[model samples]
Target chain A: MKKTVNQKAWFMVLPVLLLVAFSAVIPLMTVVNYSVQDTFGNNEFFWVGLEWFEEIIQSERMHDALIRQILFSSIILIIEIPLGIFIALHMPKKNSLWTSLCLVLIALPLLIPWNVVGTIWQIFSRIDIGLLGYSLDAIGVDYNYTQNAVDAWITIIIMDVWHWTSLVVLLCYAGLQSIPDAYYQAAKIDQASRWNTFRYIELPKMKGVLLIAILLRFMDSFMIYTEPFVVTGGGPGNATTFLSIDLVKMAIGQFDLGPAAAFSLIYFLVILLISWVFYTAMIHTDEENQS
Target chain B: MRISRSNWIMILYILFLMLPIYWLVNMSLKSNQEILDGFSLWPQAITFDNYMTIFTDSSWYMGYVNSIIYVVINTIISLTVALPAAYAFSRYRFMGDKHLFFWLLSNRMAPPAVFALPFFQLYSSVGLFDTHIAVALAHTLFNVPLAVWILEGFMRGVPKEIDETAYIDGYGFFRFFGKIFVPLIASGIGVTAFFCFMFSWVELLLSRTLTAVDAKSIAATMTRTVSASGVDWGVLAAAGVLTIIPGALVIYFVRNHIAKGFALGRV
Candidate 1:
């Protein structure tokens, strides 16, 4: 369908533009202002052109937090994507009381507030009184998230997987449902093996939604804060302190406004650059599929 | 009938999903002493005092009221603004449209932590601090983009002929949209609102930072319980259960829409 070139459409878009400007663009400018200026007590300010940015760029702590953030996001994507796909493949295909019950139950975790998710796992993984901790101890694994960094990492990773894998499943399931029965009937007539059918048919069909699911998962996991903060408080000694937690610690905990502002600009740029790359790649693939 | 391997995988996966939740619910039902006594699969002595406390206590119950008010305001504002913008993106070819769409999505990528301090300063300076509207506006920084994206996909799935036919029949754009286009895409609006509500409801950082006393969110209130007694285990667990209730209710109503196809049949 060819759309008309009408500049009147700009009027339709103005409200969104004004709203986002107030909510996003203005605060962003404030951060940019802070990034380049030095502030003293009593609302006095001085010029500090790129000094804070240079310090943050060279800081060892920022490097560690960035690396840790990348590792956590990668682990989450790797685990959740495949696991979600597998679960969606086996979910009951038709609408039934059983299927609805399963869908509702599976979706329960996602609805809980982020802090509560952290709190639930905090208590659930406690060795003295929690079910997971006691069961693991009973089986003799020597588990303790508080005293050990490795255990803390494992606990956070598992908590994230438990909290978010359902999102991927729900996205993939929605993708799977969009396929009309005609495609499968044609596949059956061709006697296509299950693996071949999935590879050639279902996979291609799910590409659009899968891209969306991956992007959403990546952004959320990369910027994760509340759950891990509540669970481990960035501890067992900075083991689970990702970039957001680190930024909060610097800006709020230490009250270093200039450095924190510079840190945020860099962090926001990284997300924008990566997401731009992803956005372009998706558009390219979409064009390819079209042609 | 023989059970397939995939069926076993899904059942085990669901069990894994339920385990922590079951633990929370089990904890919510037990006495504080019983909760710390030991690990039990089920509450040995069932009790509702934890829930009773949440209902009877003003501070606790007020948190829920504040959360609901702001979240509803956010959803309504997001949908109202996004609907026209989404319709334009779906139906018209305007200048910088592609770039505009991507830019909006990038806002969704902005880290909430980065904006926490700036939002605090901005809201306080403007006198919108400690109000429900402030958080609602802040959430639109993310939720509006999402609503537009989801709604645009659904609107594009709708054929252009409907718009043309309605216009050809002498109906105004607004009337046609409200009477025909909206009902045709009711499921899409349902999904979009569900997502907006979900993100706004679960978010802690901006909502907590932007409000102090009058509009403090339930998540922020729950955090205070943690610092209050060091471990108000049973009460915290009960609060956690109550927080999940609204999301569950929202999902129950939209489950079919989500399960159907995410309202994006054309794409």
Candidate 2:
């Protein structure tokens, strides 16, 4: 059906436009301001062009963080994507009661705040007070996030999986459910094998949602701060300090606004670039689906 | 014709997915003394002390209020603005319309860290720091875009004929939208609101950065507990468990839509 248009609809949208400009555009300009200038109280400012950016680019601190951030996000995507699809496939789609139960189980961790996830694990893994920690200790293994960097990293990563795999499961499940019965009937009549049925029919349909799940997981995992901060305090000697933790320390802990702001823009650009890539691919896939 | 090797792989995956969350509910039910004692397959003395603390304490209840207030505000602000903007984007192809939508999403792309200092500075400079409004506005930076995008999708799904049908019947655009468009996309609004609420509720970065003292959020307060004179494990666990209730309830109610055609609704 054809719909009529109204160009005057611009008036209806003016408020949101103005609000976004005020909320997003203006503060971003302030970040731009801090990135290039040195200020020594009383509103005094001195120009320092590209110095902060250059230092950030060369520093081992940033280099290490970039590697860790990339590794963490990559590891999560690799594990969660296929695993999420697997879980979605197993999920009961026909029964509403069972569907709700599965959803509740999957969403269990997403509701907990990052700090609480940290707290839960912090207590749950201690030999004295945490069940898993005590259990592992009883089995004659030394496990402590406070002392071992690898242990800390693993705990943080696992905690994130517990929290977010549900999202992927939910999205993948949605995609799987969209398959009409006709498709299955056709496959049955053709005597197609299960693998062939999924590869040709289900996988194609689920790709759109899988793409969104991957993108969302990437963005969220990249920006994750509160959990690691709470669990390790970016600690066991800076082993778990991602860019967000470093950015926070620089801005709040060290009062290094110029460098922090510059770092922030760099951080924003990295995420922006990655998301733009993912967003482009998702949209392209979406267009392909439509065609 | 048969359950393949892939089916076994799926069973293992679901079991892996369920374990940690199972561990949490298990941990929550254990008594503090039992938690400290040792690992057992089940809690030796299951107790309600943790859940009980949340119900009794004003602090825990206050967390609920603060989370609720800010979340509700953010949802309202997001929907109010995004609804009309989405209408514009779906109905009219204006100059920079594509850029505008991308710009909204680009706001989401920027890390909270990049904007943390500026948000704090901007809010403090205007004497709005540590207030609920600061958090609401900060959240809107991301939520508004999401709202617009999701709403636009839903609006697109509703063919434009409905708008014309109402318009030709002497209902102007405002009345048409008021009487027609909004009602049609009610579920879209609900889903968007659920997301807005979820994101705003679970968000710790900007919320912590923005508020202190009277407006200090639950997540911020929980972090402060580490430095408090003594650790109260039961109370902390209770608060943690309590915080999960709202989101759990939300997911439970919205689980049906979890598999619904949000492709046409998610922004």
Candidate 3:
């Protein structure tokens, strides 16, 4: 699709620009201001000039949280992406009542409030009352999210997989549905195995959507807060405290605005840098495929 | 005839998806005593008292009202701003367009945790604190970018000849858009609105930060159920159940369009 070069299109984009500036830009500038300044009570402030950034960069807590955050995101991408693709492959491809039913059920978790999702798992996995915990105990397995660090990590990961895997499934399912029946017919004529059909036909066609799914999952998992906050409160001695959880505790809980602001900038920068790399890499591959 | 292995897999996966939700519904129907007593496959003494309490309590029900109001407002605002921008991006290449587009997407990637405190002060200083519109406007930070991205994907599929044809037929830009172009991408709009509504509705950090009492979201309000005495497990479960209703309804209404929407749109 060749697009005309039209500077007048800027007029069309103006409204979104103004709205985003109001909502995102001004607050961002405030974070920048706070990052560089030292402030006491009663709104009194002094110029601190990168002191907060220096301290944050040197902080052990920040380092631990960053490592934990990266680990959590990696685990999430690993589990959810393949699982989602598998489920999408098995989903009813034909338009029927069953397809709609499957879609609605698959999407249910995604629509629930983030905290509610946490609450659901919190209840469903409690040792005293949760179904999973009670059953696990009955089976002679030791498991308690509130008391065990490994258990806490497991619960958070499972909860995330339950909450978000549907997104991947839906995106992949859409990609799958767009493949014409003729492709499968050609595969059948060639006596291709299931793996061969999936590899050559499905995988190539699904690349665009797969990239989008991966990017979304990465960003969202990196910034996850509410569910983990509600479920564990980043507790068991900060075992599950991802960066956002740690930042909120610092900024809101302890009122360490300057350090928290600096932390926020670094956190945002990490996401920006990684996503830029991802975007360019995916787009480059897409162009290569086209040629 | 026996079910195929693929059918069995599908059934098992759906069951896995529904198990937690089923537990929530089961808990919602049981008494607090029944829940704490032990885990049961079904509610032993099924009760609607929890639902009754939520309906009769202003604090409980108003949370739902507030959430719905802000989500609706945010969707409308996002779509209104995004539609033209999406059209512009889809149809024309302007200066810094790629950079501008990426910049918009970066906002979607921004962590709400980072924005929570600044938004608190930003809303507070503007006297928009504790208002529904405050959360609505704050949500636009992410939702607008997403709405634009999704809508742009759908709009790009429309042939360029349609616009030229409309102009040649003497249809004005606004007239052409409202009359022909919008209807063409109606499902796309539905999907974009659904995504905007879903994100805004589910988001807790910004919504909780921007509003305190007058406009607290249901998600934020659910936090209050955990008191020193103990959590109101039944009522809490009921509130969670109620929160899912609107979303379920929306999904049902948009069921057919969803696949097509995603197939065409960028989301």
Candidates ranked by lDDT, best first? Answer: 3, 1, 2
- By DockQ thresholds, what CAPRI class is model 2? medium
Cα error, residue B139 of model 3, in Å, equals 0.2
Model 2, DockQ value? 0.52
Candidate 3 wrongly placed segments (more than 4 Å): A285-291, B263-267
lDDT (Cα, tens digit) per residue for candidate 3, span A18-77: 999999999999999999999777889999999999999999999999999999999999
- Model 3 residue B26 CA deviation (Å) reads 1.4
- TM-score each candidate: 0.97, 0.93, 0.98
Superposition TM-score, candidate 3 onto the true structure: 0.98
Q: Best by DockQ, which number?
A: 3
Query: In model 1, which regions exceed 4 Å deviation?
Result: A288-291, B1-3, B260-267
lDDT of 1 by residue, B33-59 (tens): 998776678988899999999999998
Predicted structure with the largest lDDT when compared to the true one: 3
Q: Write the per-residue lDDT of candidate 3 for residues B176-222, one digit (tens) a residue.
A: 99999999999899999999989998999999888788998898888
lDDT of 3 at B12: 92
For candidate 2, what's the TM-score of chain A, rounded to 2 decimals? 0.95
